[model samples]
Target: MSSTATHTDDDLMTVPDVLHVLRPLSKRTFYRWRETGKAPICIRLPNGELRIHRSDFKEWLDSHREQVAA
Candidate 1:
């Protein structure tokens, strides 16, 4: 799938999927953010895998947007 592809809220994104969108950022940093409550909220599966909802990720990204002077 292309990086620009849109995902529904029901779509669960894997770590690689997020890493794909957040290129140039390391997995270590991603985990660090997750640890510090700075990353998008995630769901832990019974098998101990993490999944992030598209909506939550979008919301997290939107929250970080810096308003610029027009």
Candidate 2:
């Protein structure tokens, strides 16, 4: 199989990467979302680091899409 077949698995993102893209203004705010179940599904590794699958993150972002008045 070509690498593209595994692209989905290779695109997992860390919390910092997600925050960088979302730019929600603060880590506290993101943490609050996680705590309140407003954020996307997050995976907690046995070592304690958090992970978010790329597809799940995109779905979460799309689900919360809102237009802001420019």
Candidate 3:
């Protein structure tokens, strides 16, 4: 799929899926954020997969918004 491609509505994104659309980062750093409560909320499936709602990820990003100096 293209970089701009997005999941269909009502889709639950896997950890790697979410990372694909966002900035690339090491899995170590990503999990560190989760442990420190800095990353967007994630849920673990009964089968041990991590998932996040696209909408919730957007909300989390919005809440952490900051201005950058040009």
Q: Judge candidate 1 at residue 6 and give its lDDT.
A: 69
TM-score of structure candidate 2: 0.75
Tell me the deviation in Å of residue 35 in model 3: 0.6
lDDT of 2 by residue, 1-70 (tens): 6665444744779989888998864778888988998988999999999999999988888888898999
Best by lDDT: 1
lDDT of each: 0.92, 0.85, 0.80
Worst 10 residues of 3 by lDDT: 5-14
Measured against the true structure, the TM-scores of the candidates, in listed sequence, are: 0.86, 0.75, 0.74
**Candidates, ranked, lDDT:** 1, 2, 3
In the predicted model 1, the residue pairs found to clash are none
Candidate 3 wrongly placed segments (more than 4 Å):
1-9, 67-70
Point out where model 1 deviates above 4 Å.
1-6
Residue 2 in candidate 2 has what lDDT?
62
Kindly list the per-residue Cα lDDT of model 3 for residues 1-70, writing each as its tens digit.
Answer: 6789666545677888767866577778888899999888888999988988888888887898898999
Q: Please list all clashing residue pairs in model 2, or write none if there are none.
A: none
lDDT of 1 by residue, 17-50 (tens): 8999999788999999999999999999999999
Instruction: Indicate the TM-score of model 1.
Output: 0.86
